[model samples]
Target: MTVTWAGANARRLARQHLHPDAAATASPFAAPGDAVAAMLGAHAQVLSAAELSVGLRGDGLTRTDVRTALWTDRTLVKTFGPRGTVHLLPAADLPLWTGALSAVPTGPNPFPGNARMTPDQVEEVVAAVGDALTGAELTIDELSDEVVARTGPWAGDLVMPGFQAMWPRWRQVLHLAGHRGALAYAPNRGRKATYTNPGCTPLPGTGALPALIGRYLYAYGPATPAHFARWLAAPKRWAAEQFAAQAASGAIEEVAFGEAGPAWVVAGDTDVPDAPLRGVRLLPYFDAFAIASAPRERLFPGAAWERALGGGQAGNFPVLLVDGVVAGVWHQRRSGRRIAVTVEPLKPLSGARLRDLEEQVERVAAIMEGTAELTVGPVTVGPHA
Candidate 1:
């Protein structure tokens, strides 16, 4: 069956719990942990972004609540997850994430010349990382020292053309350690962060890939093997093999998405209700809903494609959604107790939509623990715009 774009949008809104009426449901998430689980995970390249993403879903949740889950309660973990980017996942799900991610072969090291470590050296660094963080939280410098001591002095050699100054060769293994469940970001120590083991023992089996793919489809379908591969940063062939196996087992089925052609969804998910999309959300940067959806042209549409996405890079800026579709881009700036939120809409909004946007601005400010002052009009997008 061919699902119209609007039909898909409606289904997506319901699945994402973005429809306004979903807030009143009996099982509405009461905490950040519940929200994270419902969404599969929250993109967490920025901690504040993840907090806002959770707060947007859960009624009465706050940044402090998210912090409590991540730090005090330890119900959530910050680690390199889908797409090899930092994400906030429910701590209990670490085994599934680690098992699935560990199976994907590592891509070529980006660092050039002596900066690049051989596969054996990389494995040694990964092992050293596990040793360094076992039962202890250590800052990057401390972890680097431990790696150099365990692996050799070469692990500490500086590699130029790094993200910020020259980074140590050992740094390359950090994400791999997280993917392998041997490392996770610890609560901040003063102004710096540390790393620790997630403490989840992997399940003794190979069901992880199928389980993960199933969860992904449930949350982010109708997607293709290519989409899954891109989302997981796995090899296309590996994703295709997994998809084929799942399909053979009747775990997934194919359907046509309007204009986007064939896609796959978890079996039995083809009967989604056509819920009306009725809400405005100030989705923070790297919000999972926007990033997970493919056929960006349909999701963003027209000028919004350029305005909201900004050169096709997802997560560069927060987005403004009207009735589950990208309508604008927004930014927030703080000055004392007030946050100035500037929204640039690709098209004029209805009075009701404008009020919804205002309410969303208030929500954003509340997440920041400050009063909100909104400006709707021509605003330039920039690093701090």
Candidate 2:
């Protein structure tokens, strides 16, 4: 039997706890870790956006709550995740992420010979990084000094491009070290961010990918190997092989996904809701829903395809969702105790949707700890940095 996008969307929204009724009374998540685990990980390259991404899905969670979960309770760890980008993942799941990510073959190095490290050198740096951050936090510069001290002068060569400056060659393995559970973000020191070791051992790669794939399907099911490949930036052939091997072992199964054709879901998770999700949501840039949902054309139909997406990328601009589809673009600007919210709807909203939009704005402002003024007009700001 074929599954409709409606069914897929309903399952995904419910799994992510983004369904309309998920906000009523109590939260489904016991803590920020539960929320982070629900979506695999929350994009954290833009920390504030990541906070809103997790906060909106959780009940009555403030920005401070997310911060406390990360820096205080240590329930969440900021590290390099899928596609080698910064993400906030559940601390307990570090082993899974590190193991899965380390197993994926990295793409060809973009750096020149002088800047890139050999495989052995890469291992040395990862080990040195782990050793340096074992029980203390260090800023990037401090880590560089320690890495050079431990690994020798070649490790300190200034050849890697940074913020208009050259970083040390050892910096090339920073993400790898993160994926090896040797590095994670610590609380900011004055204005500089610091790194520390999570101190968790990573599972072997062979035993981790199967579990990780099951977790992925649970959060974004009715997917394809290509979808999984795209999500992790892994090679398509590798993803297909992994999925095929899993299917042969009865870990996953395939089903028709309406017009989108054959898609895979966890073997026993084929059921879907009778009705699709319906609600008005203001999703910040790189929100998991905007990024992880597949068959992009359906999620960002018509003009939304051109406006909501940036050359097929979903997270460059914050999106306004109606009934689980991208309906508009929105931007927020804060001034003292008030926030100015500008929304540009692709189509005129009905009265009910307009009311829902206002309510959503109120929720956003509350999470932001500010009063809000909404204007449904063109958003003049450019994409976030």
| Best-fitting candidate, scored by TM-score | 2
**Tens digit of per-residue lDDT, candidate 2, span 1-385:** 6789998997788777788865552356657788889999999998989888888877788788899999999999999999999999999999988999999988778998778788899899999999999999999999999999999999999998999998899998999899999999999999999999999788999989999999999899899999999999999999999999999999999999988899999998888887657778899999988898998899999999999889999999999999989999999998997999999999999999999999999989887788999999998888883
User: What is candidate 1's lDDT per residue for 268-362, written digit by digit as tens?
Assistant: 88865576667787888888888877766777887877777767766677888887788888888778978889998878989998998888888
Error of 2 at 222 (Å): 0.6
Candidate 2 TM-score over all chains jointly: 0.97
lDDT at residue 53 of model 2 (Cα atoms): 82
Those runs of model 1 whose alpha carbons end farther than 4 Å from true positions after fitting are: 24-26, 383-385
* Clashing pairs for predicted structure model 1, backbone only: none
TM-score of 1: 0.94
Under the 3 Å rule for N, CA and C atoms, how many clashes does model 2 have?
0
- Give candidate 2's error at residue 184 in angstroms: 0.3
Q: Rate the local accuracy (lDDT) of all candidates.
A: 0.82, 0.90
